[model samples]
Target: MENTRVLWLYIILLCHYHWFFEEIDGLVNLALKKPAIQSSTFLNLTASLATDGLIGTRSTKNECSHTGVYHRNPNPWWEVDLGGVHTINRVSVLNRAYFAERLRDINITVISQDKTVTTECAFYQGSVAAAAWATVTCHPGTSGRFVRIQIYNEAYRDVLTLCEVVVEGLSPCDAFYFRKHPGQRLNSQLVEEIQSNKPMDCGKACFLTTMCFAYNYNSDTSACQLLKIGDPCDTTVSDPGWDFYSNCLN
Candidate 1:
């Protein structure tokens, strides 16, 4: 009976482990391979390394992003542009294996596309262990186009280093306003015209524009038109080559 109980317990643990991974795999890392920049570079370690999708904690592995020495640089920071605005859920930072204490007193912030708004996602008051992942859950409805991580303190100066920065969130287009109307165009007030290759880009353009309520994308010509007056759900004219997306729903 003892052996049977042990075997059953092992099976339950295995199932739980599988379930945990499955839930994690369902989340989308919005910061993956996005355009990243840092305040300064240490040697050849660039900001892009932090978002390279590698979680290797060793600095020698060339997977970590490092900033200039602390004394020379007062506050070190790394930022990633998520292409467009997103409702951020959480931010995870993987500490370097050698000196994990350097990642302490970090501030993670979210910035708007227009650079007029900023929100603090999380702040770590203490150090994270080497090779360990420090995850911070953002407040509900925390949304932005840029995610920035910085280390700053008057008493202590530390270079910012990150093995990997994972941001999980929902894209702006995933909201209720992102209804697609294919082969249609909103004949409303025109805001501006820009070159775009895909519907998603057009939607992002509309989202960034203050007066833009909708956008029309022409797949054949790669032309994007921002509209000011109405959305795609309103009275739209049939245009086989154009696709309409509304940014006013949400």
Candidate 2:
């Protein structure tokens, strides 16, 4: 009976250990099979190949995503959308077997969901070696939905090639959730007003603005008013052509 109890305990601990490792592995690669886009494609090598979960560094094998040549694409860039805002930890890039020096002077940036705010994650001044992995730890508090890798040198045009790009991060649950109120407008604490025809654009404008907590979009006049306070229904007044979007959940 003692031996049987010991064996059962060992089995339980082994299962728990396996489950813990699996959960950790799931958070290691957030860019796998995500929506990826690039400035231009070279031949048939598309942007999606970089996030296809293949780490093969041979460009001839068609496992890498390549951009057009210097003259064709002066500023080559590659980006991956993480679907939602996430706190990015690090980004890894695998260089192709041939011509790995093309990735020199590349800048990695994290862009907000509205595409208005950009934060530099890391920059590689030197060329990454052929068939090697270059891992970049993002700056503290770097969070965004889009990860962009681009060559910023204007002296010469360089093609951006990525064999495999991996992003590891944490996806927080308390993301911004906008609630819309039709025929209403928040009347107080106006920050800035912009001409925007769509409610999505108005919401995005408010999202990147640090002082904007809510926004009112006028349908008839195409005016978007960003408000500093987030009193959704309490402070809003009835407006015939305006709609209010609040980021406050409670």
TM-score of every model?
0.58, 0.59
Per-residue accuracy of model 2 over 27-102 as CA lDDT, tens digit each: 4576889999999888888899999997798777899998876446776899999988888999999988987667
lDDT of each: 0.80, 0.80
* Residue ranges of candidate 1 with Cα displaced over 4 Å: 1-26, 153-158, 171-250
Listed per candidate, the RMSD to the true structure in angstroms reads 16.2, 16.2
> In terms of TM-score, how similar is model 1 to the real structure?
0.58
* Number of colliding residue pairs in each model: 0, 0
